[model samples]
Target: MGISEMRRTGEGIDERSNFIMYHKGEVAGHRGVGFLVKLNLKSQITGFEGISDRIAAIHIHLPNHSKNWTVIQVYSPTEQATRTDIDNFYNNLTEITEKYSENNLVIMGDFNAQVGARAPGEEQIIGKYGSGKRSENGKKLVTFLLENNLTILNSVFRKKPKSKWTWLSPDGKTRNEIDYILTNKVKEFSDTGIIQNLNFNTNHRMVRSCLCESGTKKPRPKAIQMNKTQISNEIWNPITAPEDLMTVATSDIDLKEKYNKIENKLKEQTRTDITKSQQTYLSEETIKLIEDRKNLITKKDKKENQKEISNLSKQIREKIRKDRIIKRNKTLENYISKTGGTKKALKELREQGKEWITKLKDKNRPTISRNKIQNIATDYYRSIYKEQNPNQTKTQLPAKQQNIYNINKIEDIPEILESEVEKSIKSQKMEKAPGPDKITNELIRGFQVNGQNRT
Candidate 1:
């Protein structure tokens, strides 16, 4: 549930560790507003802002929904409060609402006001079900609602006077319906009412609403589990063995032939092992339960059907979670076996190094299709290298300049020493990009020459 008038500071709050809060000022902790999202729902929060101590908003991307939802929880000042405070609250609320105009908007909280029984002209904004008389604050709220095109959901829903009243006086003689749930999309909220039984040691009762969202549930993507250890054992070990290396080294085969032979063997082994390991993780029972839940929703059995769907959804999620955990453990085990128990340290280093490179590449890439990007790159390079004067006569260098360039004859140049060549190859950075032959400096250093590794 979203909260308002929290009266807390945001200093030292661990935003990364769930229970996110956004407060207006650090020094003035008298009144603040923030969202209290459940652990499951926390992942769906796309954006949030604390407009002021009186207003706070959060944007959430709901599952199976096309559009995001922006829920703004406010703590409007009472009628006796300063006019400046009230004006500031409304201004902040307007700015937040306008910013999230595209999203499905829900603004709810203790407004400290009542719309009373709907007047003739106010029928579009409020219904005839509101309790008590309208105060000066209530009039301001009504005008704000009209300006923003929002419907007061609490006023619109018909209920008993006792159920309609959200707040009670300390003396137990006075009661009012100041708390409300308002929305820009009136049709989305099919039902709204006050829940009086659940007490939170507060004067305000909970306001409940039934929102009918439109979306279709999409199936989760299938996971492909490959046994890397099996592939390494059956393919890589033999290909990299000393005997195989000696055979390849002694043979008169071209380098391309040697590379193709190794590549083909590795590919064949990988396919065979991966095909054997591949299996559907989601069960038929889970799929059937999902379909049943969808059928119940389509039939519009809101109460019991929704409860059953919620339970089924939890079960499906749990099953998926367990399957993924098992797959991850299996993959980790395979990696450990392949690396001979050095997987932990090596994996951590490799992941940390690759993360920056991956992020940089993703940031540089345009948000266009692969074909479009390729075409653009090709066009750019072609234009850059295009000859400006193809028909112009070429100029020849002067005889003295040509003679200077040919000072170092092929016979006059000294042959490079083996020690110097080895030192140069070893000094070359291993992280540098591969050359035209697609061979790395490290790979060159690893090659055996004269019955010894180059480096």
Candidate 2:
């Protein structure tokens, strides 16, 4: 079977680790809300991604307890970066990691930058294709390694001299060592600092580090099988001595008061019935006396029931009313924060005026299309021009002047011709506001005109 077949055999971990505890009772890591389960290796290995750009997933290689190798995969599907950029990106890899003391710290990837330019003592060439110089981008990568205090274990200086280059360009024109194997602990690489190149038929060269010799193996941890059904009996344990005492006292007092009121009520009802019967029997001339007593009993029972129901209804209504008042106050406070109360009336009036203007403008818009109006105006202009200039040839003026003349007629048409003529009439009436009468004898002698008043 293939590696995929091996992975499929261990697929029982699909739903086992879907939920995880991070911190104390934060109720987090649910799928889609904060994280999502991403499957790889054909229903075998599972992963998670965040809603935000980057995601980090931790897989428990061991059976129990989080003492396992964590995979921090940074997926940048659309990003193409210089060596400096990728170096800066993964520089803070160990910042938030829960470090395991005895376990291994394996950091291996396609670094995309070489260790040194021309085997250390040569002039550096930056960004020149296939130049083996320690480029400026390469320096940034070195700085990132130094800042993290992570050793470049795959370095030619540390490894054997013959095993320097690990990767080569497919075009045969360029060859440089780029991929890396790094670790914080020195024991992770078996003290030899060996870097061997594997001639695999892939873009990446596989670099593996061993912590022990072939016989001395890492100790396997015991499996911790959790019984899911065994809930902790002390789950709800807290300091409840004061609350327990208070509850006992309150319950006792409430029961005593309730029983006393019931007893008093029963006595008062018996006395009232006796008084009613005595009054009824004193006037024994009344017919249907038995029916009257029965009606009285029924009425009293109904009144008692109705009184209890009304009290309960009032209690519910009062609670709802108080809740509504609180909500209304909160809403008012939010409104005040947005717009102060001093401007509320003015704001309402302004909104009303704006709405009115919008409605009026919409009402006044022309029902006919602009082209239809243009045709009608052209016909009216032709008629007006013919009436004004009788017996004249159509090509008398320049073509531009003729067009202008036709346009001028449309403008000079009567004000009553347009639709919404009432508004136009109202506007004219407003413009021609009536002036004070000046028909006195002195004013009549001052003008001395044959036409109307010039004063």
Would you estimate the TM-scores of all the predictions?
A: 0.47, 0.28
- Residues 1-455 of candidate 2: C-alpha lDDT, one tens digit per residue: 00000111101112211232111111233111111223222232222212112223333242322334443333221125664645445544445233422343445444556656333321121111123456454565566556555555554234433345555454434555665555555443464232332211232334545554434466757854433234222232222422333344357467777555434433333334334433321122223333343343345343343344344445545555565565456556755776566344334223221110001112355322223444556676888877655666665788899899899988966565444553443344211212343122222122222332222
lDDT of every model, 2 decimals: 0.67, 0.38
> Clashes in each model (backbone N, CA, C under 3 Å)?
0, 2
lDDT of 1 by residue, 1-455 (tens): 66666777652122432354544434465767666665556557665556667787767888756778888889898888999989988888888788778888999988998778777777788866665778888998988888888888987777877678887665445778888888888888778987644413355677888887567666667865666666556643432543455666468899998877644443455465445645565567766766765675455333445456567667777876776676566666766776657556345323221110001122466321223444566687999999988889888889998787777553477888978886898788743556554445544555453556633
- Check candidate 1 and list the clashing pairs: none
Model 2, TM vs. native: 0.28
Error of 1 at 125 (Å): 1.2
List clashing residue pairs in candidate 2: 117-133, 117-134
Off by over 4 Å in 1: 11-29, 216-455
